[model samples]
Target: MSCEECCQRRGLGGRMIPVPGEVAAGCGLAWKTAPEAREELVAALEADGVPVEAMTVIELLEFR
Candidate 1:
């Protein structure tokens, strides 16, 4: 997927994972990335012609 490819190309920290339960509804998946990467990521996604619905930043107790 584009998310995975974007991270790999830029060496960003993230992965494709199941969307958190609290979110209303979605494709049941999301690309988890560092909050700091949002801006660059948005640009990359736009360049890649990916339509982004929403992006949220939250603290996770652990991510690996």
Candidate 2:
């Protein structure tokens, strides 16, 4: 997330759930979401002109 204020600006509030492993890895913060939602998320970001190349999609090994 950009900042605590970012969520409020985007009206995302509680929707921006935190990812577990990211904080442990010192990655600051990440969005918690299901693997199946990847495509829709990517499409939404792209549609909003958010450059998504820097977005990393990590699939849990067990899910694979």
- Model 2 lDDT per residue over 1-64, tens place: 4432443455443344344463454444555455666666655555556543244556533352
For all candidates in order, the CA lDDT equals: 0.77, 0.48
Give me candidate 2's TM-score against the actual structure: 0.43
User: How much RMSD separates candidate 2 from the native structure?
Assistant: 6.7
TM-score, one value per model: 0.75, 0.43
- After TM-score superposition, the amount by which residue 56's alpha carbon in candidate 1 deviates from its true location, in angstroms, is 0.6
Residue 30 lDDT (model 2): 59
Q: Which ten-residue region of model 1 has the weakest summed lDDT?
A: 20-29
Best by TM-score: 1
After superposing candidate 2, which stretches have Cα over 4 Å from the reference? 2-24, 53-64
